[model samples]
Target chain A: MSSDAELIGRSLRGDTSAFVEVIRRHETAIGNYLARRVGRQAAEDVLGDVWVAAYESRATYDRSYPEARPWLYGVALNRLRRHWRSEPAEQPAPDLTRLAHDWDPWPAVDARVDVQAPLRRALARLKPEEREVLGLVAWEDLTVAEAGRVLDIPAGTARRLLHQARKALREAPEVAALLQVPTT
Target chain B: MDEMDLMKKLSDVPSPSPEAYDRARAVLETAVAEPVDTVVRPKRWFSWPRAGVAAVGAAAVAATVVMGVTGGSAPTGTSTEAASPVVESPLVKLASEVKAAAAQPGDSSLVIATKTAPDNSRHVYYTLYTDKGQIFTGDSTTLASSVTRNDDQATPYNAKVMAAAREAANGDVEKARIAMITAANNALGVGLDPAAADKAWADTQAEVAETFRKLGKEVPAPRPRPTGKELENRINNHLWSNATYALVVGAANTEVRAGVLKLLATIKEVTVGETDLDGQRVLTITASPDILGGNASAVLTLNADNGLPIRDEVFPAKDSPQPSKHAVVSYESSRVSLADVAAGKI
Candidate 1:
């Protein structure tokens, strides 16, 4: 099977089907990324939007990095930002309110860490763009450079934002305490 | 915890309902399958007679202007008392009303008249209402026409013209009705033109029906009607009618909304404000995104009077700015609720 980079190269060379392959590979990850920011419902709309947009602007896809996952994440992030801004200010904030609702991990690892409340509090305090950068890195497991690529920013800038975001999170009493407890 | 673990939480965030992907994919495929003519070429369709009349009116206004310039007897059309609120510029008045409408919600009503100069173009009056349940009752110039959701789908009635248009394999009448309905249903009622779209849809339908009819005997079985969201999306999105473009742009359906949201993400900021057209108040929302080569802003404006979208203007953006690119969108209603019709309410 061709790697994602090879598929992207094929897509840029006019193979639209190859692009679909790219979408199929990352659609779930993109969907999860959006759902984390906006709730599940809005996330669906956002996910489709990201796909359509990425497909439409595929001509500008920089082939330097054949793996399009970071690029796709970037497109999805921009869409998420726009959706948030278009909404009336009074509407519910981004679903980053991650309060650890009824979520159970398979294999039942009982880490009774109520880290969600503090995480939510810290997230709310960060600038909108900062939260985006931090969330992409931490939650999406994107490296600083990958996070930067997703946000259309320089990798160094992304690293700075991540560092600043961590500093801020650490300063928060709730989040600081949670950070002290090691993850099993 | 370290950043990696925190980031891992993002994986836990559930994906959106699968239906949304279905809807979005359907919308994008529709958008992709149908080519949208976003070039807003200026339309000069005024009839010769209307042009002559406008010339005369312009001459009279000009004469008054010259007289005022020369400090002549207070100018002919200038009655200070008449120039008061009663004679305020329709656009300005509409702007105020639009501002008011933006603040309120749930079952509001307004009536506004609009004009498209180069008078050959149709002029329509849209009256729109949003019920407490968010069910919108929308109608246009003629009272017999209106549109509302019936059976979770938009149905038109007293709709001989619409039915005939449909039977004729031209979806113009319904398209026109929906354009108007979309305009009327919006909080900032904007007008739309379904003529070009109707023509295109009609042509496609006729072509399809003709092809099927020609193949009738040769094929062992007739083609079945398209069913399910996938097929519906295929057909609906395939219709490259101009009106469909406006409809998709103006209305907030699941597919269209997804497309619009995607478009918005590529941009930096939007310029949304109030304006007026032909004595109707309108709230205009324009966006100048980083996309589009930074050439132009896609402007969507709605008339506040009846909560219908009246216009969509794609003009030059900050770079190479000019009002050269323009297209007019207008709509008419085909059906209304029984309660509204009984009350003689549009």
Candidate 2:
């Protein structure tokens, strides 16, 4: 299989089918990325725009990176912002709201942590960037540096944000139940 | 579970449905398929009318400009209100009423477009449109679970036409006409000053002359600048086709229908009259064979109240043995949920 970088390079050469392969590989990841932030319905609508923007801008892709996933996330984020900007300022971006709409806390792992109130409040209270880095790492399973790449921030800044975010989560009085879980 | 692990568990979302992936892919593919990105400037239809040439013979420059269903460039004696929307026709004024009517509420638009063949058989397409400006296509009449979803594809032209229609919702009909024509083919709307337009038309004339010369065909006499009746025909032709283009893609849009109704009113060649169709009042708007650039004529039947198109047809010149050049089309549009449509509820 061609690396995403190789495919994007091929696509720039006019073999558009190569780009379609890159899309098939990362579409699921991109879908989850948008769904986490904007809900599924909006995600579906914006997903096409992301692909259009990505394809048009493929000439700018830095092919040194074998993985296009982070680059794609960056593209998806730009489109996501366009969707969000249409929304009023007070309605915080929907990153955590998708959870409020769909998450019923996992009772089987440990029913006591099922209290979503503290988790939601704790997540919401962190400065927007810090919460974003945490969500990218925790939910998207991206490395701290990879999260930074998606946000176009330096790795050290991303590390600091993650650290602050974790600390906030641990110290919140409302999050005591979540932290009390014995670390493996 | 660790806090990060807990966050992970809580944030899980379903993978995008195949329909979602197809929709997005279609957008990329449409861009890929276009021969050139027209962002710099809209390209003139490289294909142009070889009309009046002894060589290529009647191959109209594929135009937003009309040369359909009729023959010749002679004006059909309709006077020129084409330049401006002054002296509001009763039909054109109805646009304000239609525009003032509240838009129907819906997140998704469902349009079932049916095309009838000369043989009398029909092909039906089930298309779902998003407010976000995407369309999913399906062909089943009564679909099973296996065939529940629409095929993802939206031509960029369709998006452009609908966007123009939305913009027309409040603007003057003349401006709306130009917007719709430009949306059809960006080249037509650009360079609208009389001098710039005539120069472009002259350049097209030279190109036409060159095309005939290259083919070793005898060159037709040079067409003077497309002015008066000729310019009116081109503008009118582009408007009619683009308006049909808007309705076919987006009749579910109240503003689109209203805009099209308003703009269509301005085409004097388009005659609108009411008729009784099985005890129901319907308006039939016709483009006589003369205006279609030849002998073929177009008729669009609409609901008397809302102006939504019920059926649209084109018939070849009355004497021509060739079957009607275009497939006869009709449609039903409604508000529906994407999930329900995906689940085969329609």
Candidate 3:
């Protein structure tokens, strides 16, 4: 089978069916990406816009990259940003209170006591940019280089952001306790 | 937890439903096919139409001014209120009421509607839309029915029309109007460009003129391209008719029904009056003849207390083949459980 890059090249040359194939390949990943950030309902609404934007801008895709997943992520991120800005500030993010529910993987009872609570707080405290880069690595399974491409930042910058985010989490007393990491 | 562990937890967040993914894919496919510059955003229900009225009305005034200066005999009998810049809030209030009623959760929505066919036979349809997205349809005349779980099959209404109504009710009236306009263009197979008003007018006029010529009728003298007001009115008429159909046939959810009501309120050409339906007091809302594209007009009668449609009446145009005939489709809606529908209890 031709690669995603090849499909996109064909799409740019007027083969819309090729683009549909590309969408089918990435829809699940992209849907997951959106659901995680914006919750499922809003995520579904944004997903359509992401694909449309990607299709319209397919001509500008850099063919050097064999995979279009990172570029698609970038498009999704831009749309998410726009959605976030447009939304009223008073509206709370999707219910993450469930995150603290009993799903602790740690064997120790003491360690199991609401580890996700502090982790959620720690995740929220990171600067938006750092959180985004960390999310790409941790949640989306993107490498620092791939995350950099998604965010349109240099790989070094993405690495620095990810490192900063990890350090911030480690420095937080609650997070450190949850992770059982000794504070320096 | 270590970074990998934290990442694992994050990944544990539930994925979007397959249905959502399918819907998004469909939207993307449709959008890609028709490459328009505008992005379809979730509209805030009531905000859209107010702005639309101002913009379209301004264009109409500008067109009128240009015509006067050029010494062209301006068309007589066009409503000057078309140029009125004030936004009416009565429709907005009614829309809110309808939307509130629609939001009440239910297992299934049952629509009992009777349509008078061109052959003068009245057919009653029983459509049930479950909250689970399943649809069961039956009719009185044919005694024929089917059950399907497809979203597209739940209602025979236009998706775009329902979407516009939903947006309008959600307070994006202007966005809903744009959506309606887009739907109208799609239905008419004419591109009504917002930026290129003259071109839209020229294309529409040319198409109409050609149709007239094909009928061997004398083509009238060519006129100036339609102003934004005229175009807005045309689209709003289409929107109103489609919205009415959606309410009676396809509105499975209250939000959608409410949106259609809200969108309907934005059209100034529609007049709201009071009448008796089956000896019960109802509000009768009628669209103007011009908006309906002929001498015939559409009247939607709704239960005043609940805002649910009671009946839909289509008055035949003066030149219509059935000039003396008018069609009335009465509606009865209720909440029913999915199991009951499955058991054929409806």
Candidate 4:
């Protein structure tokens, strides 16, 4: 399969199908990225926008990175920040914990009793940067360096932020209890 | 549970519907279908299609370094210039002459823009267009990058004007006129009557607002369409710019060139002046201040014999929004076969 950079290079020429291929490869990952930040409902709405923004700026994408998932995560995060700031007070934005419980693809995970509230509270307590790096690494399955790239921060900073977040999660009374609770 | 396990358990957001992805893809394709050809616009950036910003007085010096200037033209008056023998109109006579002349010898149109400013840096553009409307553009003077349309050199502007040019070539001046202007600004193709104009204005405002909305930015209030003389001036301004682009881009094609001349002949606001440069005669086509909304005016210089566009300029008036940003862009066109272009031979 052609790399995302190769697809983008094809797009800069007149062939738009190459770009559609790039989107096909990453849309689900990007859709989930938005879903995790905004609720699933809002994420679906914003998914198209993230794709458009990514498509418009694809010319500037660095070809060195073999994977576009990290770059796409960065684009998704920027759109997410804008979505957060622009969302109105009365409008709907379900919490990730609620969204997770509402619909889980995995039968075992869906059947498992929800212990997300304590972790959510603990995650909320961390600094925004720490939470961002932690979520990217733990939730998005990115390496520390990849998370740093997504956040536009250094690998060292992302590692430190991840460490701080993990330590805080360990110390939080609510999260510590959830960790002690047996997983079926 | 470990931190990774704990986070994984929390992040099971439902997948978006396939329809959602399809909607986004359509928006991108809409943008792609238009002239995203080298134009990098941010979400909120609303570039007025009619408003032209290019070179004027100082651009002559730059033109001299590149194309070699002889006698210069201020291009102030529209009424007095002989592009050819005394006929009903100078432009009409020139158009007839060009139409009669053989099309430039090339399977494709080779349009070059060699720009030099005060910085002493040199940049050249070679844009080659097939009669079929495929475009190959690159910065190499040798046309080194003008390979296949699937190559990185392929772009999307000449195709927009190709059909319009073909129409003009076929002698449907009115249809070509509409096509040229509308291609420049899609909204203008609609009627500018009170009801039609209002609807077009509303559509434009909505599109601009949607762009901002998509970027998650505050939507700006739409400006009301201008009334009375203000609307006429704006219309003329766009008409002039539209005609100018069609004329310049399609200069290599005999029918497109003659068709643009016929289209320009209809616009009362557009005036022609003939002048000599380096003993070679050329025509200075001017759109005066009255035609433009503000004091700003624009001029396009053309080769008198064959009607090839040489230099185009915008002299921004006192009330112009961007005086410092004005530029002087010149053109030099030649003929080359597609076979040679594909081979990277100039």
Candidate 5:
């Protein structure tokens, strides 16, 4: 199979089928990324625009990069920013905990304690840029350097942001308590 | 929680549903089917000053609308022989309207169109055309206040359409129709192959089938090779569809609008009627059913006063999926000067 870069090259040459293949490869991850930032409903709405935008700008894709995920994330982030700016002011914040419904960290005996709530709050409290870098590295499984490319920032900047986010979470009272607990 | 656990939780979201993926793919397919020029350029963040200038220019043009600098030729009824109750062909009536509208002078034309998708989401576009070959466009999210150039091409598609319309504006309707057809074919990248027309069509069918297989779509059964008048009709229909598309998307030029109306009139099955669109008397042109196969019908509504198109709608066959789903695009147009647009004076 051709790499994403190769497929993008084909797309620039007018082969849209190749671009469709690229979308198929990354839609799941990109969709999840959008859902994490906005809610799932909004993510679905923006997904198509992102794909179309990416296809249009495929000519600008850096062929040196073997994978197109980071570039696609960059496009998705831009779309998300526009969506955020255009959203009505009265809209409520997205509930990040929606993703954790399938897995409960606390068992029956400890169910009374909601361990995930503080983590969600801390995640929300981080600076927007910091959260983005950290999420790309952690949730998206991209390297710090890769996240930097997505944000169009220096790798050192991305690394520092990730470090600051981690340090803040470590110091949070709720997160500290959870870390101190024993784990199997 | 530890970083690993935190990461795992963050990544635990459910994947997009299959329906979502399908809808997104369909959007992509529609976008790709059109000319590649529709690709959107990524916006630069530090362009506020430029945007401000454009906004000022647009405001100037809006203010000038009251001055009547954006005037155009009014639609005139076609000449009729004395005591003849013979009804004019729909094409002839529409052609006459286009000619009358083309007679009115304007420096530029503005067009606003909205496209509604199967999901019911609407994408609105605003376009402006200057006689000197500059095109400006915006959308509902970003109105005409911050219009951008249509493209880097010196002679954009709109200008080309306008030039062709002007060429055909001469009184000879038959000659004008031929010119419009040639222009539409050129725009659509459809070439004439007199010597090997039959073989060329056969090869085209094979290529289409191959493309379908590559895209994982079912290969559709190929019809018998057309010959003589059937082949001629097929070719003309293909060109007609292309011309109609160009007209819908880029008919801001008065002459181009006139040319399109004339070209559409040439199609025997296209019927013209009078109706009210938004309280304004308008001429409606409805394409014959099955003109483009699948029993689809395309209807174009034009402003009866100046022969400008107000809407273009396509209704798919009933048996097809989502029979109620129709593609509708509504248009709004004006005339302005290129110099004013460039100087931030509107």
Candidate 6:
């Protein structure tokens, strides 16, 4: 049986179905990634575009790396950039209504951590690119290097950006206090 | 929350509304759609009575001759007459001229702005430029990839090379076939069925070339000319091969065809004609679609001598409800030049 990597290789050769398989495999992760960056409403609008773009551009995909997720992320990131460009510069504060719209906590583990509102406020203060790196880490669970691949930046540069962004947030007194808070 | 905790929370975020899934699904459906086949395949090309399986090649060659001879004599039917010598309708003429320019020796480039209606819903515009050997595209996607092949030569667009090659074939018929073959083998991003793609490319090129030559134009020297009936046989082979592939790949689904055509219809047809703009021999083309409703046409001015498209005036369809009623979506040069593109001149 050809591994996922082999199937990707087939797709590169002209088997579009192989590429389609890749999408079917990773769409959930990609959906989650977009939902985090652009939120649910716009995320849904842009996700299909991301998949289509990825499918259309499958020829340029660098297959040395087996997992197609990073490349798919790159496509999703580009769509997000265009979407951001079309929207107004001063984005509205991420309110509870917005957060609740996209996310709901798992009631059994930990209820009522309303800290997301404050986090969103702080996130709004960051540069768009900075927010991207932060979201990839804190939302997408991407390693710095993987995120770098997705962003089409060098791993070292991604690490540096992550370090700077982390330091800035860690030093923010409110975030620092939140960091210190022990969960039950 | 720690970064990991936050990351987990972000990943698990729920969609805000039910409509999100529907919208995403629509894009996915559009993404999977294909063009060309959507226009019911006329029992054969334009539905000329089917030539025998063995004589299809000879038949296509004969058809080309008949078409050429019949050009002036055939009673004017649906073919739109040239607007006027003074009024100057040059879109088809420019398309031919550009095809000729692409054929000349040294590397040449031109930019084309394409819009397609995947369905009746919306029209998407993409500005694409190509050096005779490579193409650079910008539109819905950010990466500059090949419309032909996935090879290293493809650069930003290695992924969709095969599809691009097929599209090129549909556009110019001759040139696109050659380029598509090159893409099938060399394009890097995806694995192409090289044997099938290569055979298809070679056969289609020869068949189209023969058709063109029989119509009385000089056979522009192909790299390695295949034999006479070889062209005919190849085209037939290709059609059957493609048909087989489509059938096996399941291209019969009507929704897929309808969706793709609907998308293609959204792109207004652009017709370029020779004219004077700023003291230059410019080809001015107007883009419009019948159904998009009111002023969905854009007038573009290109350098006629060199076939470079420069300026664009986008007007709302006469029925447009949008505010900028009849306005121009502009460009910087007569043709989309690669040098200018590299400098972000667009």
Predicted structure with the largest DockQ when compared to the true one: 4
- Give per-model TM-scores: 0.39, 0.48, 0.42, 0.51, 0.55, 0.49
What lDDT, from 0 to 1, does candidate 4 have? 0.59
State the displacement of the C-alpha of residue B13, model 5, in Å, after optimal TM-score superposition.
Answer: 6.7
| Highest lDDT scorer | 2
Interface RMSD of 5: 9.2
Candidate 3 lDDT tens digits, A1-184: 9899899867654565788899999999999887777667778778877877687556446666889999999999866655654456476435323322221212221222334777777766677778788878887889999999998789999999999998898888877887788877
Candidates 3 and 6: which is better by TM-score?
6
- Candidate 6 residue-wise lDDT, B105-157, digit = tens: 22223323332111111222333424333434343333233232222233322
By the lDDT metric, which is better: model 1 or model 4? 4
Kindly report which residue stretches of model 3 are placed more than 4 angstroms away from their true locations once superposed: A1-184, B1-90, B101-105, B117-120, B129-136, B140-145, B148-157, B184-224, B317-324
Winning model by TM-score: 5
What fnat does each of the candidate structures reach? 0.39, 0.48, 0.43, 0.51, 0.36, 0.32
Superposed by TM-score, candidate 3 places the C-alpha of residue A58 at a distance from the truth, in angstroms, of 39
Tens-digit lDDT string for candidate 2 (B1-346):
5678757766766567889988777655544433222211112111111121111332333321344211122222222324646346545555566677776777666777777543233457666677777666545533223224332345555666677677667666566666666553433324265454445455555555664464445666754334566556666776676677677666777777777877777787888888977687878888875556554678888877776678877766776443235546777888776666666666
* lDDT at position B235, candidate 2: 63
lDDT of 4 by residue, B1-346 (tens): 5766888887786777888877666555544433332222211111111111111123322221111011111111111111111226688788889878765677777777655432223346566666555555555633444354334332334454556666765756556655654453443323334455455555555655564465344665555444445444444444455556555555676776776776667666678999997788999988766665444566778899988888876676676554322446678877678888777667
Cα lDDT tens digits, model 2, A38-79, are 767778988877886777556446665799998899888766
C-alpha lDDT values of all predictions: 0.42, 0.62, 0.59, 0.59, 0.57, 0.42
> Could you tell me the TM-score of candidate 1?
0.39
**Model 3 lDDT per residue over B102-200, tens place:** 355557777887664433334466766555554555553211224422212432224566677667767556657656544534322223333344444
On a 0 to 100 scale, what is the lDDT of residue A59 in model 2? 47
- Sort by DockQ, top down from the best: 4, 5, 6, 2, 3, 1
Local error of candidate 2 at residue B276 (angstroms): 1.5
Which stretches in model 1 have alpha-carbon errors above 4 Å? A3-14, A88-115, A181-184, B1-11, B35-346
- Candidate with the larger TM-score of 1 and 3: 3
DockQ of 3: 0.16
Residue B310, candidate 4: how far off, in angstroms? 1.3
